[model samples]
Target chain A: MNIILFEEKEISSTYHIQITDHRAKHIVKVLRSQVGDRVRVGVIDGGRGMAKIVAIKPKFPFSVDLDIQLETTLPEEKPVIDLVLALPRPIMLRRILSQVTSLGVGRIFLIDSQRVEKSFWQASLLQNEQYREHLLIGLEQAVATRLPEVSIYPKFKGFMDELLVKDLDDYSALIVADPAGTNTFSEALRQAGGSLRQGGRVLLCVGPEGGWVPAEVDQFSGCGFSICTIGERILKVDTAVIALHSRIMALREIL
Target chain B: MNIILFEEKEISSTYHIQITDHRAKHIVKVLRSQVGDRVRVGVIDGGRGMAKIVAIKPKFPFSVDLDIQLETTLPEEKPVIDLVLALPRPIMLRRILSQVTSLGVGRIFLIDSQRVEKSFWQASLLQNEQYREHLLIGLEQAVATRLPEVSIYPKFKGFMDELLVKDLDDYSALIVADPAGTNTFSEALRQAGGSLRQGGRVLLCVGPEGGWVPAEVDQFSGCGFSICTIGERILKVDTAVIALHSRIMALREIL
Candidate 1:
């Protein structure tokens, strides 16, 4: 576990972490961590700390005595890479959540695209916050302490013209994933370079499974957004996101 | 499978397919493929054909009668890109499979890296036909007919010496993945171009989880292998494979 997450109530007056919740079961039952075992712990929206187990109750509502100490604290200045993507099918949505969080993105703006399967948007996984849980699981795997804010945009043009570009004025770069566009990923990163310099507040756009219909692609292209291809192979959307970031990261000398 | 795989068989005048394995289960149970169902099929070491099923019986050794006609297939040559990689964990292996297939590589040489967990090699998923399953699945996704040949070399030195430089009378470009290497993926790809034009195989090596150690990097550099970085963020190996190919495929001008 990179950083074991906890809620505020888990912390005591002396800054000791009282193990509880699902993670508590994981530590005790699954991991079988005994007394004196070191367990990494961090408050969900709080500081990172590790606890040394001094005691345990290995049952429901389990508890563990804590001797907590802070380790590497994260920087408070969080940069967001909010993705505004057309909602994909349930299976693809599951993968996308993991990919976004694994890449350290901070927000998701799931928008409707003409090509997106109408039935896919209505999937139970999207309507409720179950996708949120999956994204959180990915974040946990990535050791990210922050969760990306997820918002759904049911309408396309209304979001693009009225809310997005206007409200996201601080964003230094905006990227859209389109197969037919001319610029390579390297070129896209060059355009996105401004975002890293200004801080990590950037916006990325990806289309649905069938891809943005010709009209939607035209609409996106008319904006200053550059289309970048990760490779000649037609990658699934989740693979594309990871592939896109990998290229961008390499160009920035951050591999 | 995007394209159902088949083995060559001399069937009855009706051209029956011996549906005795997983493919049979998939067709019968999953696809509910019945008599008169047409399916795309690729003959092993032969050509792709469409089969119209004539009959299906759940005999102890089940069989499906097929009327197959092979196509006038052009030989789509596999690029002489030999991948020398540290076997990534199972999770990473899935993406690597697809990425490698998409890159149009001819062969893969999986090696054990120092940083690679010993237990990873022990995973049953990497043994037997499991790895091939991953590759076939990936190839299907790309709608590509040819499957890359894979060779597993558990030891690093054997891979580097025998299968690598020893096979070369002419210069085979050697590029290794390194964060602080002599060049970037672009520079390295450029260097590989001259060798590629000379008509020898191109050998690209990607490191495992934490990457090749400094001494290993130095060893490759001494052997005239160019050390290159993908970028700043340490991407998972799966992402790196796709990203590396993204640039390489772009270098191919097929993008």
Candidate 2:
């Protein structure tokens, strides 16, 4: 972990915090930190700064509780990009969550697609505490305090009918990456760049492994989503998410 | 696998071939092909075509042998991007090999850097056949015939002094991604887009997880590499590689 994150309730009086969880073990063991050593630390979804280790007390046979003093923390800047992804396989989901969060996405929607495996919805990675673990790793790696909110959607049609379509009103652009798309992503962005509306936040949609089926593509197109291609080569969902989002971030000059 | 790849030696006659390995099992079990089913096939480092299953026989308890006819095939096109990367952890390297191969990199050089773990050079993933396995998976995913050539350099200073400097003669442009870089990747590409020279190939260098030390960055800078940044957010090595390469490909109209 690059930065240690703590919840607001965990902070003690006099700006000192005591940690007895994985975060404490990580600092004491993995970092091999000693008392009086200053390390990068951040409050969850709050501010980030350096923390001076004040005490290290053995809490269990192999774990320790750390007392640290927080100093000179600053509020985090908000993230710009948000992703609406077809829930990937559970293994891929874990990696994507950490990677995309490190890449600074503001939010993520793990919506269902026709091609998504039914069994994927039952995976434990969707659990809030479990999901939060991956995002914490991401935030620590990026040294950022803001946490990207993650929401899961298990029914494709229901999500589309109830929220996906309406959520388009909040974004400046709604893009779908499709292998069969006639226009390249850059071409689509160039056309949309001239007249972006709303909060300048782009809501990008990436499909599952086999990609969006014909009806799904048609539905997204009907919702005013610009269908675009990366190229003829087929990329795995995780790679495509980074590739597509990175290009958009580059073109927007946000990266 | 999107496409089944065959070595040149695997072709038995002008139009026929037999497969008894994992590919054959994939064709029989995963794809569930019958006598007349057509599947995409490609000759490694050669052409791509569709193969029709002519015959199938059980080779072992779980394996099968198949006779196939290649109807038509065309020569593969060349790839535009090549990479120079600091070898990541073995697990990450496996994902990167497949992802970049799927994304269509022409070549990859896994080189040493200040931040690279010395033990990484001894990883079994560096074995030729094991490495080729990952690349083959990538080519199969992308449905491409050609495999990217992977090279390893264990010594940083030696690699720079001997090969990296000399290799600069071959590429039209050499670009390195650094967070401290003055220009964004797009800005660098826009400048180079005006006058791309010799072979239209760009050699991209991406650092390790912690990134290049100042000395290493200075050496690369001295070699006429345009230092470019993706953004301020710290990206994992794999994410940065895809992000940087995708932007380059998009700007070049290759994606």
Candidate 3:
């Protein structure tokens, strides 16, 4: 991890905090850190912190001295691109999580769809924190300090009723990824004009293996989602997400 | 598999061929073919084939009325992009292969860099035939039928000695991806002239985790390569490949 993230509960004081969970074990075991070595650290939704290795006694537990109060908000320039995906197979889900996280999206919503196999939900990877580990690796690779909030909703109807229509607010553009959709991503991106530096929210939705049903398409359309495509090649859910995000970033001129 | 690929040695007669190997197992067991079922197949550099199940007797053997003909030819469009990637970990290799293939690139040269872990080469996934499986999946996802030729040199000096000093063959752009590189992808794309559809070979190079040393950058520039970036946000090797491909595609209007 480039910048270690800790919850508010982990911070015992303004400048000193004790790490005893994964971070501590990671620092002591995996990293094999020695005394006087400095490690990059941060807090979740807070600023960054640096931990100086004060003591290293393997197995017993190691200690570090924290001296940080970082204003580690995602740089104001990078726009938040949130994705709504109809969960693919387990293999696809792992890649999607890493790709979306690497793109620096603010969040990801794994929603259920008619074409999605029900057995996918029971995969061992999704049961434990296996999926979240992938996201952490993505975040670390990106050198970003924050991880996207990931939540799984069992059914699209419940997600629509409980999350989408009622809770989501001030979205600049709501895009549904349909291969045969009317508008092209280029046109949609050009139409949804905004400076990514201003923190505009763009939501991208991807369907399942068989693609979205007509009734589901109508529901997304009714929810004011703009349908778009990234050329004729039918990219998988993860590939499509990165391609779209890159194009949007280009249009926004954030890069 | 959209189009089954066979080696030159695998082709026997014009109308018939032996059914054995891993694919044979998948076709017989996983598919549970009975009779009169239509299946799509293709040859290595040949064309797509349709094999109708004419006879089957559990484990004993099976027969099919095979029609191996070119239903359609893959686009003659020469890939404008040539990818040079410092090899990634085994798990990420499949994603990289498929995504790069989906991007419709002309060549992918997975190389060794100073910081790249030597142990990566030992992974069983790197075996020639095994690696081909990942690329096939990518080809099917993007609906591009032509398979990319993969060549592995294993050692850094060997790779440079073989291909580095060779004539670049009127290649217009030489782009390199480094985390701390100069200029954003937009600036680089705009400067690279247009995409490959206009007949320009752009060599895009990407470094591994520890990134390129100064010596490597110096060598690249000496041979004609300019280091570039996607943005401040760090993207992993796989994500960077797609993002860079998307920009090049956009510049060429392929998006």
Give the winner by TM-score. 2
Order the numbered candidates by DockQ, best leading: 2, 3, 1
Candidate 3 residues lying further than 4 Å off, grouped into runs, are A28-32, A59-65, A69-79, A122-134, A161-164, A167-169, A194-199, B8-34, B49-51, B56-65, B73-76, B122-130, B155-164, B195-197
Local accuracy of candidate 2 as per-residue lDDT tens digits, B47-162: 77777777776445334333444554554566878999998999999989999998988889999998998988889988765899999999999988888988788888877876
Please report, in order, the local distance difference test score of every candidate based on alpha carbons.
0.68, 0.79, 0.71
Q: Could you give the C-alpha RMSD of every candidate to the true structure, in order shown?
A: 5.8, 2.7, 3.6
Q: Which parts of model 2 have CA positions greater than 4 angstroms off?
A: A57-75, A164-166, A194-199, B58-75, B197-199
Candidate achieving higher TM-score, 2 or 3 = 2
How do the residues B136-246 of candidate 1 rate in per-residue lDDT, one tens digit apiece? Answer: 666655555677878777777776687545554434567787767658666665666666665556678889877898877887787778887654444556656766755
Chain B TM (all candidates): 0.81, 0.91, 0.79
Over the full model, what C-alpha lDDT does candidate 3 score relative to the true structure? 0.71
Task: List model 2 lDDT by residue over A34-124, tens digit each.
Answer: 7777888878887777777777764453343345555545546667678989999888999899999888888798899989999999898
Position A157, candidate 1: lDDT = 83
How far residue A6's Cα lies from its native spot in candidate 2, in Å, is: 1.0
**Docking category for candidate 3?**
medium
